[model samples]
Target: MNPILSNLRNITLTYAIWLMIGCLLAALLVLTNISLWANALLFAVPSTLVFGSISASAYYVARSLPMKKRSFFVVAGVFGGTALIYGIIWGILCFFWNKITLLFDESWAGIEMNQHLASLLLICGTLLYLLSILVYDVLLALDNIRQAERREAASEMLARDAELQVLRTQINPHFLFNSLNSISALTTIDAAGARDMTIELAQFFRQTLALSEQQKIALSDEIALCNHFLTIEKIRFGKKLQVQMRIDPDSENCLLPPMLLQPLLENAIKHGIRDLVDGGTIELSSKVRAPWLFVAIDNPVDTQPSSAQGTGTGLKNLQARLRSLYGDKSRVEWRIAEQVFRIEITLPLERS
Candidate 1:
C-alpha cells in the first residue's frame, strides 16, 4: 500500500496539491488565449485530478528501485519509460474528454483538441510524474532514517535494563552474609534479641524481594526498607550505630531505581561508624527543589588508619548505575574531610 494513501491526512494533502495544479493548468490555457476560464477549467481540472490519482503509483516505482540499490542509468531508464507511458495516457484522456464536451455545446468545451494541445499535455504529464517520483524518493529516505534511529534507541534500552539487573543482584549477598553472622552470634548471648533480629531480617529480605522486581520505587518505600535494614543493623551494633533522617515531605514520593541507596548505607557502616571509638550517627537527608531531588548521606570515620578501608568498588558501582539509568541528568559525588565522609546525589525528580 502507498504510505500517502494509508493515512487520511496524507491523502487529503495529496489531492489538495493536485487541485492547485489543475487550477494552474486552467490559468495557463486562459493566458495563452486557448479558451475562456469556464471552458479551460472544464477541460483541465477533472483530467488533472485523474492523472494525480494515477501518479500515486510513483511511490511503488520508487520503492522498487530503492536509492541505495539503483544505478543511475537503470533509474533513468525506468523513470523515463514510466513517465512517457503515463504522459501518453494523460494526453489521450484529455483529447477524448475535450471532444466529449462538444456533445453538449461549443461554450462547454474547455479546449479545441489539436496536435499542439496534445503535445503540451503529454510534456506536462511526464514532468509531473517525474516530480512525484522525486518527492516519494525523499519521503522514503526520511522514513528509513527514522526507523534506524528507533531501532538504535530500543537496543540501548535493552542494554541498560540488563546492566540494571546485574547491579540489583550485586546489592545483597555480602549484606546477607553479615546479617546471618550477627544473628548467629546473638543466638548464644541473647536468644530473644536473636529471634527479634531474625524476624526483622525476614521482613527486610521480603521487602527487598518485592521491590527488586520493579524498575523504580518511591523514596518513601526505599526509606521504609532502609528502616528495616537499620533495625537489623542496630540489633547487631547496639548503641554504636545511630541514624538521623531529615527527609523533605515533597521528596518522599519521588521515584528512584530500587536498592540505589541501601548499598551506600551498608558501606557507611562497614567502613565509617564501625571504626569510631564512640560510634556516631549516619545522617541521611533529602530535599526536592522543583525539577531536582537532592540526597546526602554522611557518616563519621575514624582518624586513625584502619585495615577495613574499602576499595571504593561499591561507590564506583553506584556511579555506573546512575550513569546507566539517568545518563547525564543525574550526579553522584563523595568526599572525605575532617573525619566525616559524605556522599551526595542529584537526580531528576520523577513522581507517580
Candidate 2:
C-alpha cells in the first residue's frame, strides 16, 4: 500500500503540502507578469493537486529498489527517467486543461501557454516528482531500522532463555547426584535412615519440578521448598546440620525467579558445613526496604582454607541469572571474612 494512501492523516497532510505548492506556483506566475492571480490559480491549483495524487506511485518505485540492494548509478538512472516521464505527462495535462477553460471566459479561467512558461512548468513538475521519491526512500530506511531493532531484541530474549534453561538443568543434576550419594552412604550402616531420606528427597523433587516450570515464583513458595530441602539434609547430616530463617512477612509475597535461593542453601551446606567437625547453623534472612528486597545467607566455614572450599560455580551462575533477568536492577555479592562465608542478593521489589 502507498503510505500516503494507507491512512487518512498521511493523505490529508500530503494534499495540504501540495496545495501550498500550488499557491506558490501561482505566485511565481503572478510575479513574472505571465498570468493574473485568478487565471494562474485556476490553472495551477487543480493541476498540481492531480499531479500530487499521481506522485504517490513513486512509493512503489522507490520500494522496488531498496537502498542496500541498489547502486548509486541505478538509483539516479531510474529516478531521473521516472521524473522526466511524469513531467511530460503533467505538461500535457496542463495544456489540455487550459484548453478546456478556453470554453469559458479566458481572462478569468486560464493562463496563456507560452514556450517559456511551458518549460518552467515542466521543470517544476519534474522537481516535485523527484522530491516525492526522496521522501519515500527516507520512510523506507526508517522502517528497515525499526525492523532490525525488533529482530535483535527477539534474538537476545531467546538466547537468555536458553542459557537459563541450561543453568537450571546443571544446578538440579549437581544437587541430585550429591543427594543420591549421601543416600547410598547410609544404606549399609542404617537402612531405615536411607529410606527416610529417600522419601524426603522424592517429595522435594516433586515440589521442585512443579515450580521449576514457572518463570517466577513467590518468595514464600521458594522458602517452603528450601524447608523441604533442609529436612532431607538433616536426615543425612543428623544433628550437625541446622537452619535458622528470619524472613519478613512483607517480603514473603514478593516474586523472584524460581529456584534462586534453594541452590544457595545447597552450596552453603555442601561447602560451609560439611568440612567442620561441629557443623554450624545456616542463617537465612530477608527484608523489604522500599524499592528493594534484600536476602542473605551466612554460614560458618573452617578457619583453614582447604580444597573442600567451593570453586564458586554456584555463586557465579546465580549472578549470571540475575544479570540476565534484571540487568542492573539486581545484585549478588559474596565475601568470606572472619571464617564466615556470606552471600547477599538485592533485587527490585516485585509482587504477584
Q: Which one wins on TM-score? A: 2
Candidate lDDT scores, in order, read 0.89, 0.91
Candidate 1 per-residue C-alpha lDDT over 33-69 given as tens digits, one digit per residue, 9 for 90 to 100: 8888999998889999999999999998888886677
Instruction: Specify the poorest-scoring 10-residue window by lDDT in model 1.
Output: 105-114
Tens-place lDDT per residue, model 2, 1-352, is 7778989999999999999999999999999999899998998899999999999998988898977789988999999889889998899989999999888975698778999988998999899999999999899888889999999999999999999998898889988998999999999998999999999999999888889988889999999999998998898888899899999999999999998988899988888898888998999999999799999999998886468657778888898889889999999988989899999999999998
TM-score, candidate number 2: 0.94
TM-score of each: 0.92, 0.94
